[model samples]
Target: MKIAFIGHDLKFLNDAIEFFEHSPNISVKIDKWEGHEIKDEQASLEIVEWADILFCEWGLGNVVWYQKHKKPHQKLIVRMHRFEMNTIYPSQFDYHKIDKIIAISPYVYEEFHRVASIPREKMTVVYNGVQTEKFEKVKSSKAKYNIGIIGIVPKLKRLDRAIEIFEELYRRNNKYQLYIKGKHPKEFGWVWNNQAEREFYEEVFRKIENSPFKKNVHFEGWGDVTSWLKKVGYVLSVSDYESFHMAPIEGMASGAFPVVLKREGVNVVFPKDYIFETIEDAINFISENDFSTNNNLKTFVKENYSLTNMCNQIMDIFLEK
Candidate 1:
């Protein structure tokens, strides 16, 4: 089958690309275009004409565009991943404009129902997954009070919240560390054109560095996950909201006990083996546990959220019709 994938916020990596490419009888012709570069109407119509199946992410504009010009025989599938369900994707579009909808988690689909007419059978939960071999468990040397926060564009991640909790932890014992990876896109040479945002990040980074408990903090820029997971024993994902925060799951794969907040719809979707209510409670829980139980934790995540499982879940949805 000839398939075309449309994504703007995230570009699928090599593994994700290869996973889709190797699917049974699939001939993927990925169209790499962002929302900003979508000025060419002919380009979109051409893609719509070429694809037998369409996969889109968080782009309702594309959804409308596809509805306007998609071939009657082509299969349409839109994937929703952002936290804002009602605000981003409204119900009006679902009445006649779309076909299959893929959500990263069950909670995400529940949220999607707020504005879409998708029934349980029409929606599928395809969890965002990572390669277990790349983000495999590591031999953590010691259980320091280190916290790891990993993401690319973190508008809602609320790293400051994690910083505040760590500040409290450091007050009792000054051995804690917060290792921040990922290069700041708004800070480097790219900032030369957009100085205002650059200055804002400069202030943000400065405050993070001077955050009362700065001595224990370390700014380890972007690199491999295996190398950094060793320095952190626990992960704090205090984001404003999440459709599917795969970072915490990846952290779990690396043996770092994730102390994630119990999202409303997430409890039903993700296993309750290690979720905690508050940062304090999570801290206490992590203090008592060691990396020796990493295998069990990793196994739980691997079974539910690994790349193979994620792809299989999605394939089940595509084949359901």
Candidate 2:
């Protein structure tokens, strides 16, 4: 099948590319209008119309804009990432002339229901897949501490909460240093809604500047997860709502503690007591918990969220037909 993904998002294009690498008969090409940038807008529209199936994500909004003008007939499978569908509001949702939907988490699908009516069969929940072969555990340095957070950082991510948690940890013992691998919002000081998000991110660099913990907060803008995992000593993801994803999964793949927030609906997959309620609690737990003795989470992720399991489940949907 000639599957074309329309997005600049690394996951939408890269993940599918990874699958195609392993897939026997599937042929896939991902472009959120690469030709448009070089040639003309009409040139990009040609690719979308030609594709057997279209996978739209991240910058799909850009294509939807063209849909208003060009009227391309691409059977879209819109994939929702974590940041795109956090709230269930009319303004928040971006509508495309789509045939089916692919959500990285269930939470996004439910949010989609709030915006438009779609049958359960039409919307598929395909959890994020980790390239386990590349992101396995690394030897942690005992003397030098390296705590990290690996994901897109929006306000919902609660990276500040992670910082506070670390502050407490440092007060008790200053062994661990922190690395937060997310871009800070460019209007943190002003009303974020009023300021453009990218502009706000520009301001955030100035705000966090010259702070005491500035040395600890390392912002390595998005890159190779497998390579990043090797440098990460620990991983923290404290989001308020998740369909079921983000840093924790990648961290777990890399043998990080995979600290997540304690929310009510989390019991479906995550075991009891897996959620941490407070920063104080996380501080205390990490201070004493010996990771060498705790590879249980490591094993759980290996068995469940591995690449083979994720791809098999996705292929199951097409095969069922």
Candidate 3:
């Protein structure tokens, strides 16, 4: 079958695409629409028309294009990641034309259901696939004191909370340092489209600046996180929300314990022991645990969240009669 993937989030789609492309009798193509809007109308329509199925990575204006131009026999599937749910775009999708809607997590499916009035059967929860091989690096001895956080631009990521937890750890022992893997919001103005988000970003910046442990804060710009994960003892996912946060799972694969906040759908992905409700609780947990020992976290992720597993589930849905 011929499949066309449309969206700006091609980076996240890499593993899934790799799995699909290697299968027999399957062809895949991707169109890069960076903004909320798709500027190349003719190219977008041509790709939509070429595919037997249209898989939109984000439920934004590109989905609207599919809603208008998708062929009668072609199946339209829109995957709504975390950020799109906050916008009005989900409501704007023409469900009559869409064959399936994939929510990356249960929480996102629930949120999409509330907005779209779509049938529960029409939507499926497929967790993000992580390249476990990339994260199988050995952890350095120095990693015991370094804490890591990935993806810093989104205010929803709650880097401020991660900083607070790191500060608490530093208070007990000055060895703790935060190594952030993504760009700050101040560096990417387009991420915070509204004034409210801009204000929230500014507040987080101020908090980071005013903190006494600011000197220990390291802003490492984005790239392949596997190398960076090797230098960290623990991975922190202090997000206010997530559809399916992959960093912690990746960290676990890299031999680092992942301390993630207990978000609405965290239980669906992470073990309860790794999910903490409060920063103080997280601090206490970190203080008590031995960083040198492995908890089989990598095995759990390998079994459930691997690229092959995720692709099999997605392929089943795509091939369903």
C-alpha lDDT of residue 173 in model 1: 71
Candidate 2 or 1, higher TM-score: 1
- For each candidate in the order shown, give its overall lDDT on alpha carbons: 0.68, 0.60, 0.83
Angstrom error of the Cα, residue 71, model 1: value is 0.8
Which window of 10 residues has the lowest lDDT sum in candidate 1?
83-92
lDDT, candidate 1, 1-321, per-residue tens: 777776555443445657989887888776656562366777677788788877766645666667667777877777777533545444435535567777877777876665554676666777777777776645556555677878634445666567766777777677777777776655546453576645555666687677777877776677776677866777777776877777777777777777787666557545675666777776676556655666676787777777887777766655655
Q: Estimate the lDDT of model 1.
A: 0.68
Q: How close is candidate 1 to the true structure, as a TM-score?
A: 0.83
For model 3, how does the per-residue alpha-carbon lDDT over 77-123 read when each residue is reduced to its tens digit?
A: 88888788667787777778988888888888887778666578789
Which portions of model 1 miss their true places by more than 4 Å? Answer: 12-14, 83-97, 115-121, 143-145, 152-155, 183-207, 221-223
Q: What stretches of model 3 exceed 4 Å from their correct place?
A: 191-212
* Per-candidate TM-score against the hidden true structure: 0.83, 0.77, 0.93
**Which digits, one per residue and each the tens of the lDDT, describe model 2 over residues 151-183?**
534555655577777667666666677776754
